[model samples]
Target: MDFGCDPGEWTDAWSATGISHHWALGTGHCIAELKALADLMDVEFVEVDPA
Candidate 1:
């Protein structure tokens, strides 16, 4: 969650795709809109602090 803005597009793309580290790792999810996808995949969505 300590990502720098060197390539701001990285964050922008992730946001547009509704993806997060937790979501991709299958450990948890932080994006609210992506929760449905997680539910469909039987994944847990854990809220996280904004970086």
Candidate 2:
């Protein structure tokens, strides 16, 4: 998914168990893109810290 021109980058990092997908999104524009995606998908966006 390309969100126009940006200097931020992302990667699809997989765990050793290969059972989960982790996504690390950048700041600023990333927030907008994520919110837009959630709105388009008709889902609530919730962020939880796995501490």
RMSD after Cα superposition, model 1: 8.3
Q: Model 1: residues >4 Å from true position, as ranges?
A: 1-30
lDDT for each residue of candidate 2 in 1-51, tens digit (9 for 90 to 100): 453334242222223446445454455556778878888988776653323
- The lDDT of model 2 is 0.54
Off by over 4 Å in 2: 1-29, 47-51
Candidate 1, poorest ten consecutive residues by summed lDDT: 21-30
How high is each candidate's TM-score? 0.33, 0.35
lDDT of 1 by residue, 1-51 (tens): 445554587657667885655535322343555678778988776655544
| lDDT measured at residue 43 in model 1 versus the true structure, 0 to 100 | 73
Which structure among the candidates has the greatest lDDT?
1
Find the candidate with the highest TM-score and give its number: 2
